[model samples]
Target: MKFSRRASANWKGTGADGSGSISTQTGALDKAPYSTKARFEDGKGTNPEELVGAAHAGCFTMKLSFVIAEMGFTPGNIDTKAKVTFEDGKITNIHLDLSATVDGMSEEDFQKAAKDAKENCPISVLLNTDITMDAKLV
Candidate 1:
């Protein structure tokens, strides 16, 4: 199976002085603003790193739920946070912090499932940077 998603960005002026708006096909981020200040310094609006973090966190959490179900455990309240580190004009690393509640699952089993999901999630596979994770079964 295959799927495609689309997003668009519009920018004006030079890289340092320019500003842009990003829109997604799903309308979730219709003309959302982005700028150099937002990306490299404290400013309003969103940036690529923030969006990547959100996507990674959401993808990993969902994948973990599925992995738990596949392992014959019921998953609950899975929460994940992804930190994308950008350095020297490149994405250096991504760190995923996960906490989840599952019924009748051991710490070792949950760790294994989280590791599998972190390694196999679409975003994890798509990123061409180091990915690390810390998982806790709560």
Candidate 2:
């Protein structure tokens, strides 16, 4: 199977003075604004790292759902947060925090599913940075 996603950005002016807007094919980000200040300073709008974190969190959560289901349990709720760290103009780490509720499942099993999701998710597989996860059954 194959799938494709697209996003576009348009910028004008210097790196420190320029501004741009980003949009995705799905319109999830319809011409969302971004700039050097937005990325490096406390400015409005979204940044690249924020977008990556969102993608990672979404992918890992979905993968965890499948992993839990395969283990013969129905998941109640899964909340995941992917924190992307950027330093020295490079992405340093991604930390995934997952909290889940599953009926009749042990904490050990839930951790296993979360770990499996972190290891097998498409975004996790594609990223080259350090990825760690803290999973809890709640």
Candidate 3:
């Protein structure tokens, strides 16, 4: 079986003081606030890179939970944060921070599972840039 997902974006203007629209093949459309200030700030609106980070974070967490379960451990909570850095109009680095609340898992085992998740997750495999992961078991 083969599957693919697609999204499209229409951007205008220069690096600063421009605007754009991002829409997926599913017909979900949103606006993008173009500018260093807007992107660095609260994002007066949605932006593409932010959404990519969010998607990667969520997918990573889900993958973490699944892997933990496979190892006979159930997670009480899994929190993940993804940081995407853009350089030269491309993604340069992605940092993943994850924390897990789970029983029956020692620090060593938990860290191993988290690292496996980071290394094996679909998003991590798909990204061409380097991905750094930091995980804590609490």
Q: Is candidate 1 or candidate 3 better by TM-score?
A: 1
Q: What is the model-wide C-alpha lDDT for candidate 2? A: 0.93
Give me the candidate number with maximum lDDT.
Answer: 1
- Superposed model 2: Cα runs more than 4 Å off: none
Per-model TM values vs. the true structure = 0.97, 0.97, 0.80
Q: List the pairs of residues colliding in candidate 2.
A: none
User: 37-72 in candidate 2: lDDT tens per residue?
Assistant: 889889998899999999999999999999999999
Q: Which residues of candidate 1, in runs, are more than 4 Å off? A: none
Candidate lDDT scores, in order, read: 0.94, 0.93, 0.82
User: What TM-score does model 3 achieve against the real structure?
Assistant: 0.80
Error of 2 at 128 (Å): 0.6
Name model 3 segments beyond 4 Å from true. 12-16, 25-37, 40-43
Q: What lDDT score goes with residue 47 in model 3?
A: 68
Query: Each model's RMSD to truth, in Å?
Result: 0.8, 0.8, 2.6
Q: Give the lowest summed-lDDT range of ten residues in model 2.
A: 107-116
